[model samples]
Target: MTGANGVPEGFVPLPTSAFVEHLGGLYHAPEAPEHTFGMRVGPEHANVRGRAHGGFLATAVDVATSRGARAAMGDGSGVSTVTMTMDYLAPVDVGEWIQLVTTVDRVGGRTVFATCRVTAGDRLVARGSVVLARIRPRA
Candidate 1:
């Protein structure tokens, strides 16, 4: 199945083991029109207070937004996050799966704007916007 934008539906951007193995660094983008992704927060990702680290939350949003933009551009395009702004609304506990939902707000010749939300279960943990620049393939 394809999303309204025509990308394959239910496609995971990363494999399950990829998230499990990475511990502190893992992300998955499940296929959707909203361009959703998620990461499992492990003990290593927690802060001194034992909650998910703010940096990890930001990283998850950045990665999810970048991948979502790339998916919107289709195969063979490379994109990187040029800027990201995140708001922490709530704390994310360790051992919980944080879902990142991204939407391609705009796509221009060389730039893509995206918005993402991070949630643990039904609670909003963080939200952000990412500006990505498309880079030409290396020669």
Candidate 2:
């Protein structure tokens, strides 16, 4: 994180104007090891149990992994997620801040693999892996 509520270096915040903005304060930094992301838990992101919903966590993983893929592919190569898998290990409550650390595992001819781990401070909350297939260039 840079300053007050600022994202990490090379990371960008997903403003309220974007679709995933509903996730609330999502951010991602594509740099190695810095493939980092953060979001503060809010009321809307919680479930009846008052903890962050599974969907919310899953969505965050998707956003982080997908964007990290783009950074890995650079300017020209295109990719789209083919599958994603996540494991929930703990719950996150409102007012808590969670960060997603992701890495591009591999980029083959037609597939890319990414993995993410979500944590609240040092507590592991969730882990995810995503597979993205190359998108054919238009003629």
What's model 2's TM-score?
0.83
The reply for model 1, stretches above 4 Å from the true place, is 1-21, 24-31, 136-139
**What clash count goes with each model?**
0, 0
Q: What is the C-alpha lDDT profile of model 1 across 39-136, one tens digit per residue?
A: 66878888999999998888778777877788777856788788888899999888777878888899887888999988888898899988998875
What shift in Å separates residue 54 of candidate 2 from its native position after superposition?
0.5
Candidate 1's clash total is 0
lDDT of each: 0.76, 0.80
lDDT of 2 by residue, 1-139 (tens): 4556644456566553366775666765545465777887889989999999999999888888876777667757677779999899998998777888878999888889999999997899999999988764666
> CA shift at 62, candidate 2, in angstroms?
0.3
RMSD of each: 6.4, 2.8
Runs in model 2 deviating more than 4 A are 1-17, 29-32, 136-139
Ten contiguous residues minimizing lDDT sum, candidate 2: 1-10
Pairs with steric clashes in candidate 1? none
Best lDDT goes to which candidate? 2
